[model samples]
Target: MNHPIAQRVPGRRPAAARRPGRRPAPRPAARRLAPLALLCALASLATGCGIRATSVPVDAGAAPSRVGCVLPEDRERPDGDGADSIVRLYLVCGSRVSPVEREVRMPDGRSATERLPVARELLEELQRQPGAMEDTAGFETAVPNDLKVSGSRDGDPDEALRLNRSLDALPPFALAQLVCTLADTAAADADEGVVLGGPADDEAAGPLRRYECDTALRTHPEAAETAGTDV
Candidate 1:
């Protein structure tokens, strides 16, 4: 017996037959764009930040350090070891002035401690180069070697010391060193700081200016010239 063929529906097409191993039809535009939208969103997020994307690590230099400004125990002499002969000189350390002790012969056999000799000795010590221990402890001298000190001129105060150079000629740090060193020593009058003047020339003598080594001066020696007091 012969089988009858199926009749075609009017206004409707027959569905295409799918072959084995064949890919299905492409999805709708909306569905196909979902993956692309996700990728675009990820790319936008990566670029949204102001910083640039980098895989390589950057090298920053070592961290900064501060000077301790301290001396070793052996470097500091004991008080029992002839404390009278010990002289304290202010040295520059970490942009400020600090004291360093030194021992010197105090003019043997002299019954009286004169201001001129003691002042000269201390000034010379201030100009001298720092020792190895001092160097390691960040101590340095700012006083110029050629700077000289002499007795006061006529009509000047008995306690005044005249320098070969004028106050303005000296660097701030150097002046601070001298002022602090002298003011802290016996060369200075009791509670009067130190009186200093320039050499007397044919034109005229430079006026005397008194300097004090206060806590502010020790903290900021760069402004030393402004710390002078009226004679």
Candidate 2:
């Protein structure tokens, strides 16, 4: 027996259905993981380990140094005691020589002929420890307590000052302090600086040397020993 054919409907779409045994295609593994990878990269950029990233070079000057070169008080002059006079003593601060005011019983004279007395007094003041205020302000004296000063010998220059210790034996800063302090006082020629000699009795006493407390010495006290001129 023959079967009859079904007739088609004009301008009408047929209904679609999925096969029972088939499944839809799965998404690509790379496409699904791409968003997660991008998120991780962004997080790493935002939170660096410690330092920040910069394309431009930055300049921060030299590292900070010890001891601020500041004076603690406004004591430029001494109290009006009849016996005491105000004087400047060069002290080491921040590895440089700085002037500090002090009061001492000036040894009764100011003439060039009486330079030794003034020199001795000044040397003693340098050897003395810095006062409370001076110490707090980073002022320190390198001159030794045992160091002695005397008038120049017979053949020595009239303006020369003698030291018990050889000039080479003293520390550079100590030499610098002495030179700078004396240069500003009656003990030395203010323009020519100070002339120093070793002990009169020492066999190895070298020729007198003139040490200037110029801007160079004040700034770089370590060069004090080499900054002298043979007088």
Candidate 3:
């Protein structure tokens, strides 16, 4: 940020004054040369956009509560969409933005997407099953909990959502209701798709990779920028 100018002599004229002001009238050639100095100054120290180091003060209002399932984006996919909905849930969770397009083109030809905000539950679920946590976008929170872990301890948050969705395919929905009842022991307003993956310290390579990868991808883009460049 600091630019060094030639040391100014007290009695002598300053180096800057030696040249006429930037807008001085002169031979047409000199006027054309005027902007070149400023241009060179700009090219020397290159910075992309106005990126400054500061943990962005997260706008909590923009993010949904971790306590419950966020409402579905369209509520109606409009094309007899049912079977694959459950599997698609965990594909993206607990992310404010997706560097890739977070959209799906349904069989009916109309495409729909949602920018699901990342919550602790979503992160916890991803910790359990990183593969399942593909995009972490378009998740619809209709209930308080995504997965129902009534009597398991492996503590895979994201995978549990997939398992619970299987239970959602049950005959009468008794298991899901029971899971919700048990979760109410702690999360009183809990519902489906509200990710509640056991305690946070159960997995090692799951969500940790996501956080690390996301951080690195967002910060050190320069490394990848020139990755495939030809010498």
Candidate 4:
């Protein structure tokens, strides 16, 4: 049956309808990793081609050591009674004069005039013969027994002691002994070396002279020849 609207031409068919083309299926996971595996193998081959392993030497010895130590022993002490009241006086030992320490009994009085008495006592002690111990030790005195010493009140700066005899007539050693002993006594009274003058009757004598106790005078009494003399 033919209808006007549904009629088809004899040589040509109706325009064919379009259809979508099919996409390929995904491959297995292991099969997809094959390219990466081949790349890693090539890298390993490149690195290992020329490289070699190496080794170094080491020392094996013993260490060092040390020594031991030691210690010391103990000692004893000495006595010190009656040391504070002692005073020193120069005495002749052999040809040389040296100081000897002895005990002094200070008076109950404390006035400045008390120094003269102390000095007189010291001079008396000096004139006395040395005791048995001192004699045995070769210590003696050169101070004359009769020579007297008196304090000066003449307002003279150069006179501390007045002697009973001419200073020039005394032996060098005797003068040295007297000078040193007086010097020490003067020091006890906080005074400098003592100044001495000849007998009061010697108005014509030279000026008073000052004297000191020193190491050189002790070692060589002859050195006193120029010391304590008027210039």
Estimated TM-score for each candidate: 0.68, 0.69, 0.16, 0.57
Q: What's the ranking of the predictions by lDDT, best on top?
A: 2, 1, 4, 3
Residues 1-231 of candidate 1 have per-residue lDDT tens digits of 887976778866655543558797889999989998877778877675344558897787877866767889865573535535766789999989998888775544322257778788888988999998888889998899999998887887778888888887888999999888887565687774888888755235457888888989999998887888768
lDDT against the true structure, per candidate, is 0.80, 0.84, 0.31, 0.66
Candidate 1: global Cα-lDDT?
0.80
Model 4 misplacement above 4 A: 1-84, 108-112, 153-155, 187-191, 229-231
Candidate 4 residue lDDT tens string, 148-206: 87766456553356777777767778888877876755323355476777776678655
Report the number of clashing residue pairs per model.
0, 0, 22, 0
Model 3 collision count: 22
Ranking by TM-score: 2, 1, 4, 3
- In candidate 3, what are the lDDT values of residues 28-129, reduced to their tens digit? 877887797667567656852344546978665776556222434654333434532111222222432122112223222111111121222322332343
**Candidate 1 similarity to native, TM-score:** 0.68
Best by TM-score: 2
Q: Write the per-residue lDDT of candidate 2 for residues 1-231, one digit (tens) a residue.
A: 777754556765443433566777878999988997777677768775345579797788887866765675565557748988888889999879999878788866667865888888899899889887788788888899998998888888789998999998989999999999888677886475799989988869888899888899999999987899998
In candidate 3, stretches whose alpha carbon ends up further than 4 angstroms from where it belongs are 1-83, 86-148, 151-231
Which pairs of residues clash in candidate 1, taking residues 3 or more apart in a chain or in different chains? none
* lDDT (C-alpha) at residue 113 in model 2: 69
As a TM-score, model 4 comes out at 0.57
Q: Which stretches of candidate 1 lie over 4 Å from their true place?
A: 1-59, 74-84, 107-113, 202-205
